[model samples]
Structure formats: C-alpha cells, structure tokens
Target chain A: MSTQMLTYLFVGLSFALYVGIAIWSRASSTKDFYVAGGGVHPLVNGMATAADWMSAASFISMAGIISFIGRDGSVYLLGWTGGYVLLALLLAPYLRKFGRFTVPDFIGERYYSQTARIVAVICLIFVSFTYVAGQMRGVGIVFSRFLEVEVSTGVIIGMAVVFMYSVLGGMKGITYTQVAQYCVLIFAYMVPAIFISIMITDNPIPQLGFGSEVNDGSGLSVLQKLDGVLLDLGFSAYTEGSKSTIDVFAITAALMFGTAGLPHVLVRFFTVPKVSDARLSAGYALAFIAILYTTAPAVASFARLNLVDTVHNTAYADAPEWFGNWESTGLIAWQDKNNDGIMQYGAGAALSPIKPSFDGNTGVHGERLLSNQPTESTNEVYIDRDIMVLANPEIAGLPGWVIALVAAGGVAAALSTAAGLLLVISSAISHDLLKKTLLPKITEKQELLYARMAAAVAVCIAGLFGIYPPAFVAQVVAFAFGLAAASLFPALLLGIFSKRANKEGAIAGMLVGLVFTFTYIAYFKFVAPELNNTEHWLWGISPEGIGTIGMLLNFAIAISVSRVTAKPPQSVEELVDNIRIPSGAKAATEH
Target chain B: MNSDEHTKQASDVSQIDNQKNYWKANLKLLAKLLVVWFTVSFGCGIILADWLDQFSVFGFKLGFWFAQQGAIYVFVALIFVYARQMKLLDRQFGVGDENDADQESQS
Candidate 1:
C-alpha cells in the first residue's frame, strides 16, 4: 500500500483500539474514574506510566535534538530518567500509602489546610496546561504532515478522540490505552533504527552501531567519523560537549526534580493496589522507558551521519528524494548563495568566511556562478530539528509501512500524554476546587459529572492553545518542569520528611518558589529575550537551570519558617507516622 | 480483661524493639541506596565523567555510557532492591497486615 494509506490505517486502528478500551473499561464510580479502582497490577501500571510520561517531546523531538547537538543532549537523557529514582525512593510509596485520589488531597490532608491544597492545585493546573499545549501542538503537527490536514482541524479531531476515552473511562481508559500506545511507539521507534544501524555499520543493534566502525572501509568508528566531519565544517566535535559544565549540571538537576514532581506521573502510582506495588511499578516504568531512551542516542548519531553524508556538496538537481520531500513540508530549505548549484551547510563565516569570486559574469536566469558570492556567507541549507525523526524513515529509504508506523507512533505519544495531562487538569478543577472546596456536600456521582465536564472544557482550551499558540508557549513548556521542581517537589518532600513543617511553612514556601521561578522564566523567555544569553544569566544559570536555585530557596525558607511556626496538630502528626509505616494503605473507595 | 492487659503489657517491649529495629533498618537501607543513586547519576555521569571516559566498556566510553544508559540501569535496580528489602522489614515488624497494622486512629 501507499505511505498515506498505511499511515491512515495504522493511526485509525490505534484510535479504534483506544476507544475500544475505553468502552470496555468505562468507569461507574469515582474510585474507578480517579485511580482505576486501585486494582491495576504493578507491571501494567508501570507500562501506562511510561506511556503517559514519554510525551511528544520524548518520542518525536528528543532524538532530533540529540542528533544536532550531539554530546550536549545527554542532559535530557540523564535528567529525564534519573528523576524516577527520586520518585521511587522518596515519594511514590509514601504517597500511594496515603491513598489519595489526587496530589492536592495529600497536601490538604497532610498540611491540614485547604489553602495549601489550593496552592498545589494552582501549580498543578499551570504546569499541566503548559505541558498539554505542547502535546496538542504535537498532535496537530503530526496530523498536518501525515494526514494532510490543517493544524486547527487536526487539533479538533485530536480533542474529539481524547474526549471519547477520558470523559467515559477517566484514568482507567487512559491507562490501558497508554499501554497499547507504549507498544506502538516503542516498536515504531526501534524498527527503523535497527534497519538503519545494520545498513550503515553492519551492526544489528543501533546502540552498538553508534560506536562501531563505519562500513565504508574507513576503519574509523562512527563517532570518530562524525566528529571529523563536523569539526571540518566549523562545528564542535560530535562526540564531545560545548556547553558550560555548570549549565549542564543545573539543567539536569531541574529536569530530575521536575520529573519527580509532575502530578500526572505521580497520579499513576495511585492506581496500583499496594504501596510496595508503587515502588516496584516505578522501577518497571523506568525499565520500559529505558528501552526507548537507550536507543535514542543511537538514532541521533545515525540520523546525523546519514544527513551529513547525503547532502554535503551534492548539487541541488542531484539531491536525494527525501531531501526534496522534507523541503516540500517546509522543514528543509536550500539557497544557492554563491550560485554554485551546490548548497553549503555549516556554522557559517566565523571559521571559513566566504570571499567574492564573482567577476560579474551572468549565467542563465541572471544567476552568476562563483562571481557574486557573499563575502561572509557560510550557511545554505536550513534543516528544522523537528523534521529529523519524522523524516528518518524516508531518509533511510525504508518501506512505506515503516514510515506509516512512525506517524502512528508520533500520534500515540502526543495523544497519550495529552490524555494524562488533561486528566490532571480536570481532576484539579473538579476534585480539588469544586468538590473539595466549593461544594463539599456534592454527591460522588455529581463530582464525577463535574470531572467529565471539566475534562471536556480543558480539552477545548488546549485545542485553542494548539491552534493559536502564544509566542512563548514552546519555551514555557520547559519552565513547566522548572516550576514543578521549584514549587511542588519541595512542598511535597518537606511535608512528608519534616513532621514539623506546618501549613504556614508549606504555603509560604510554595508561593515563594512558584513566584521566583515564574518571574525568572518570564523575564528571560518573554520580557527580555536578548538578555537570556549566558553573559547576562545569574551566575551563568539559564532560566532552565534557575529552578535548581529556586528549589534550594524553597527548602531553606520552608525549614526556617517551620522552625518558628506552630507545630502541626496531633492528628496530623499521627497521619505522618501512619504514612511512614505504610502498613495499612486502604482501598481507593475508602476515601 | 486482666489477661488481655497482661499480654499487651508483655508484647509491648518486644513490639517496641521490633518497631525500632524496623524503622532503623529502613532508614539505613534508604541511605545506602541513595548513596549509590547519587554516585552513579551525579558522580560518574557528570562530575567524574571526563575522568571515567578514559576507560571504555563494551565499545562505549565508561562515563558517556553512564550518563546515557548506566545510571538509568542502576536506578531501576536500586528501586527494586529497596522494595524487596522494605517488604522484609515490614514483615519482620509484624506490620505487613492490611487491617491490623497502623489501626490506632482509623477505627
């Protein structure tokens, strides 16, 4: 079949599977809606968490970013996965033992303050909204490229599909659908990588192929060859990093803490049957995620190598099919600056500044060959990073079926994460704000109704964000992690670890952290983009890295304030002791 | 009622010891696991990466592999180990039962 037909078929079938799971597992009660009735097996919950956690950024853009940036991209790989360690060790089991339906439930009950819970809810909504916008845009991008529809239309379709499952089945449907998505996404990601690995290096495993000798009888390792090529083109060595070590450290720390605090991911643990299961499930989630994370570096290296070899010094007329294909999508472009017919792509001018070789000789179409060269020209080819993964199969000359699978995988990634984030947004509004605070007398059935309605509303807003994304939306998504790390993680950790931490301390600390991180990100990302450079950053800490300092500030302030504040009530102390023991975690329905 | 009280009084000493031992053991285990976590993720993965890159493992620079793959593998192992060890600790303290454990205020 043709590529378009295959993509439609695979994507259609996956959507059908998700909707089918939703119909089969539709929830009848709030317990089922919120925590899948708290009966999911540890391994199953793990797979679902993996799917929910690995959003479009991880599945679609991560390898592409790594491909271009090379060694500097390790921050993402290490930071994203390393946070699970913190989650499993410090947070998951204890929170699961607390047996709450949402994160705010824990904060409210633990701090014995509705205000604290509201503060947490605000943070959750902000972070989840920022994240879901990216997912919606991702879905739109995939649809526009693969399905040949407008971005706005794609987002509406996406919203309709998500509404079907999430409103009907809530966490239960989203969980099972994510498991299916995990399978689809991982299979799609690995197949092309394996084929390309074998084709280029005679190594079947992409991970090993990344380091193996090239098959061109050059006897040089793949990394060695890539480094030589990139360095010759005035770029840094591909195997080594060019980022400041402090910035790398700070960015990695921010991501790790952020991952640990993300409300949607933490909610997955609430679905499992036991506290022990939560711990084991986290390990399982990481194991599942590592399958793709480990392969990503290999994909990055292979894509970079393939791109550089295929395009360097090739005439525009002789350029390969995939190059032209991506160019039609407007993701890749070329301009013959010197009228040399061949396109140049490098760091441009700083290393090998162009000299005017033109003698005013005109050729066909009034184009002068080598005579009108710009004195300082360097770059000629413009390649978008987002295209690398999407165009990988085409670049490698893989069959139409594999190319179709990549489209399905990208959609699955975006939809799964969007579903997860939407659930968190809905739950925060319905469970935290309306039911818990405004209408405590509301029935369970009524609360569930509110949750569904909230979900629909959230999806519509998210679609709007996707269609008309603000200028800073993409950059703001990065700060969602920073905000979570700065605001929520500190409060959650201190609430559990320090029994002396009171409502005043928790609320004060969260507000200070949230405001501090937000002001920093806003100032740099929107208010003063020019001042965002390393020279102007505080201690060379970019806004992405500023969260680390914000987190530290939260810890210090919370501890000092708690020292002077009134101690928690005796019942709250008992609650803390109870969570620490973790021997009597109740059913989700017990709430 | 007198016999019940007597049994409760008798078990309190042993129960206190069990609880203390369990809590102590849990914290100790967490400390050890956390040290390893910090060592692999921050130590070998970042601070000591260049130094460790002097050696190669399975056709990968030791530090680069740690930054990308090794830390994640160790993190998975550590969590499972912690879970298994915590289970034993809970059972040892006779606190593993769902209903009988931490029932002080719930009833």
Candidate 2:
C-alpha cells in the first residue's frame, strides 16, 4: 500500500480505538468526570500520565531540538524528568490525601478563602491555555504534513476527536485513551530509533548504539564522530555546551519545578485510589516517560550524523530523495551560495530572513527559487529542527509502514495531551469557578452539564488557536513553565508544607511570582529582542531561566508574609495535620 | 468517673505523641532521599558535569550520562523507595489504608 493510504489506515484505526474506549467508559457522575471516580489503578494511571505528559513537543520536537543544539539539550532531558521526583515525593501523595477534585480546591480550602481559589483558577487557565495551543498546532502540523490536508482542516478533525471523548467521558475516557496513545507513540518513537541505531552503529538499542563505535571502517564512536564533524563545520563540539553553567542550571530548575506544578499533570494523581498509589503511579509515569527521554539523545546524535553525511557537499542534482521531499514542504532549503551546485551545511543562517520565501519559480538546477537573500555566512542550507523526527525514516530509507506509524504516533501524542488539558480546563471552569464559587447552589447533574459545555467551548477555542495560531504561540511556551514554577508551585508547596501560610501570604506570593516572571519574559522576548543575550540577562540567567529567580522570590515573600501575619485558624492547622498522614484518604475523597 | 476520664486523657496524649513521631520519621526519611536526589541531578548532572566528564563509561562521559540518563533512573528509584518506606511508616503508625477502612466501618 502507498504511504498515504497506510497513514490514513493507522490514524483512522487509532482514532476508532480511542472513540471505542470513550464509549465504553462514559462518565456518569461529577466524580467520574472530575477524577475517574478515583478508582484508577496505579499502573494504568501511570501510563495515562505518561501520555498526558509527553505532548507533541516531546514526541516530535524535542529530539530534533537536541539534534541541533547538542549537549545543552540535557537541560530539557534532566529538567522534565527530574520534576517527577518533586511530584512523587513532595506533592502527589499529600494532595491525594487532601482528596480534592481540583488544585484550586486545595488552595481554596487550605487558605480558607474564596479569593485564593479564584487566583488559583486564573493561574490554572493561563498555564493550561498556553500549553494547549501548542498541542493543537502540533496536531495541525502532523496532519498537514502526513495526511495531505490543510492545516485548518487537520485542526478541526483533531478538535472533533478530542471533543467526542473528553466531553462525553471526561477524565474516565481520557485516561483509557491515553493508555492506548502511550502504546502507539512509544512504538512509533522506538521503531525508527532502533532502525537508525543499527544502520549507523550496528547496535539495536539506541541507548547503547549511541555509546558504541560507528559501524563504518573509521571505528569512531557516535559521539566522537558527531563532535568531529560539527567542529569541522564551525559548530561547537556535540559533547560540549555553549550555554553558561548557571543558565543551564536555572533553566533546568525552572522546568523541573514547572513540571511538578502543572495543573494537568498534578490532577492525574487524584485519579488513583490511594495516597500510596499516587506515589507509586508517579514512579511508573516517569519510568514510562524515561523510555522515550533516554532514547531521544541517541536519536538526536544519530540523526545529526546522518544529516551531515547525507547532505553536506553533495551536488544539488544528486541530493537524496528525502531532501527534496522535505524541501517541498518548506522545512528544508538549499541555496547555491558560491554559485557551486554542491550543498554546504554549516553553522550560521543560510538566508537573511532566516526562513525561505519561495519565489514561485524553479532555478536552473530545478531547485525551488527562493526570494530570501543569501547571507555572507558559509552555510547554504536551512532545515527546520521540527522535521528531524518526521524526516528521519525517509532519511534512513526505513519502510513506508514505519513512516505511516510515525504519523499516527504524532497525532496520538498531540490529541492525548490536548484531551488531558481540555479536561482540566473544563473541570476548572465548571468545578472551581462555577459550582464551587459563582453558582454554589447548582445541582450535581447541572454541574456535569456545565462541565461538558465548558469542555466543548474550550475545544473550539483551542481549535481556533491551531487554525489561526498567534504569532507568539511559539514564544509563550516558556511562559507556561515559568509561570507554573513561579506561581502555582510555590503556592501549592507552601499550602501543604507550612500550615501558617494564610490566604493573604499565598495570594501575595502568587501575584508577585506571576507578575515578575511575566514581565521578565515579555521584556526579553518582545520589548527588546535585540537585547535577549547573556550579557543583558539578569545574573546571567536568560528569560527562560528567570523563573528560578521568580520562584525564589515567591518562597521568600510567602514565608516572610506568613510570619508577620496571624497564624491560620485551628481548623486549617488540623487539615494540614490530616493530609500529612496516609490514612483516611478514602473518607476524605467521599466529600 | 474520675478514673475513666483520666484513662481517656492518657490515651489521647499517647495518640498525639504517636502522630508526632510518625511525622518526624517521615521528615527524616524525606531529607535523606532528597539529598540523594539533589546530589544526582543538580550535583552530578549540572554543577559537576564538566569536572566529571574526565571519566567515561562505555564512551559516555560520566557527567553526561548522569545528566541525560542516570539521574532519571535514580529519580524513578527514589519515588519507589519513598512509596515503600512510607507504606511501612503508615503501617507502623496504624494509619494504613486498610486501617482507615476498618475504622470507618466500626464508626
């Protein structure tokens, strides 16, 4: 069968499977909608959490980014996984014991103020919306590239599928669907990785393959070969990082805390049956996530080596089939800088505008004519980092079925995460904003109706973002992590660890963290893009890492304010004492 | 009546003391595990990465391996250890899940 037909088959089959699960496990009550009736097994919840955590960014973009950036990419590898430690140890079990339906529930009750709940809801919405937009765009990209459909049409289809499961079955549906997605995505990710590993180093396991010598007669290790080639091309050694140690440290810290604080991920813990289960599930989730995370670096190095070997100094007329395929998609481009037909892949930008602008005409060599002016640098190729994973199978000449599987995997990743985020957003709106605060007198059945309505509307908005992506969609991803780290993480941690953390202190801390982190990112990203370098960054921490400072400020302010303010009420103190123990969690969930 | 009140008060004090001791034990365990967590990730992975790169195992620099792979494996282990230890702690303090279910039924 043709690749397109297979892609359709795989994507169609996977979608049908997800929809089947949704129908089989339809939610009936508010509890089911909110936390899957809090009966999910630890292993099942772990799988779901893995799918929910690994978004399109992880599935599609991360390895590619690491391929281009080299060792500095360790920041993402360590930062993302390490945060699960904080979650499992510091947050998940205690929150499970608290037995709340939503994060805001804990903040609201622990601080003993409705105002704190509203604040948390706002933070939750901002973080979740910023994240969901990226997932939608990811879906559109995969559909447009693989399914041969328009980006808008792809986004609409994605939205419809998400709406079907999430609105109908809520968390219950999302959990089971995510398990299926985890299987599809992991298989998709590993198959190509293993194929490429053997092709490059004769080792079947990518993790070991990357550390082994190249299979070719040269006898150089993969990393050694990569470092030598990159250095020869005027790029830094693949094993060395260009970023300062402090910046790397700060960015890693921010992502770790941010991951733990993310409302969508934290809510998954509440679905499990017991406090111990929550801790165990977090471990399982990380183990599942680690399978991909450890393999990604191997893929990164292997893909980088393959790219340079296949394309560098090759005549344009003789370029590999995959080159022209990706070039037609505007993700890869080559220009004859020296009037030589040979391609040069080097360190700097190939064109002045960075992205190619097709001129609707073919050059003498039949390469697409670009309006972009050639830069003075030696580089003559522009490759979008996002295409590495998508183009990997083709680059290595893998089977067409593997290519089709990748397409399905990418969609599964985007949709699964999108569903999880939408569920949390809807629950936050219906559970926290409406039932808990604004319309406290609403019936349980009415609340369920509102949750579905909120999910439907949220899906539409998310789809719109995918169809008409904002210019800042790519830039604001940092804001999601930063804000989560600076605001919600500190507030949640303080609420659980310190009983004296009154509403006034918690509110003040969140505002300070949010405002400070937001302003820092905006100033660097928009107000003065030219000054967004290490020299201008505060304490040598880039805007991406400033969240670390913001988090510290939150901790300081909350602790000081709490000390100065009156102690929390006796009841609030008792609540803290109760959550500290593992018993009575079942009773706590009853309310 | 006086004797009965005194015995009830004594039992309440002992229960409170047990709760306090359980919390103390939990905190101590957390401190130890977190030290390992910090050492592996922030210590070996970041701060000492360059220094530790002088050593290599199977072509992977020691620090690079920790930064990319070792720290993550350790994180998974830490959580499991924490889960098991906390379970034992719950049992010791008579606060395990089964005990809670039993108490609820009696009430």
Best by lDDT: 2
lDDT value, candidate 1, whole model? 0.86
Tens-digit per-residue lDDT, A451-534, candidate 2: 999999999999999999999997797569888999999999998888889988999999899899999999999999999998
A133-185 in candidate 1: lDDT tens per residue?
99998998889888888989988988888999999999998999999999999
Q: Give the TM-score of candidate 1.
A: 0.93
Error of 2 at B56 (Å): 0.7
Candidate 2: residue A24 lDDT (0-100): 95
Models 1 onward score TM values of 0.93, 0.98
Query: Model 1 segments beyond 4 Å from truth?
Result: A348-377, A587-589, B1-17, B97-107
Q: Tell me, what's the RMSD of every candidate?
A: 4.5, 2.1
**Candidate 1: Cα lDDT at A200:** 85
Q: Give DockQ for candidates 1 onward, in order.
A: 0.45, 0.66
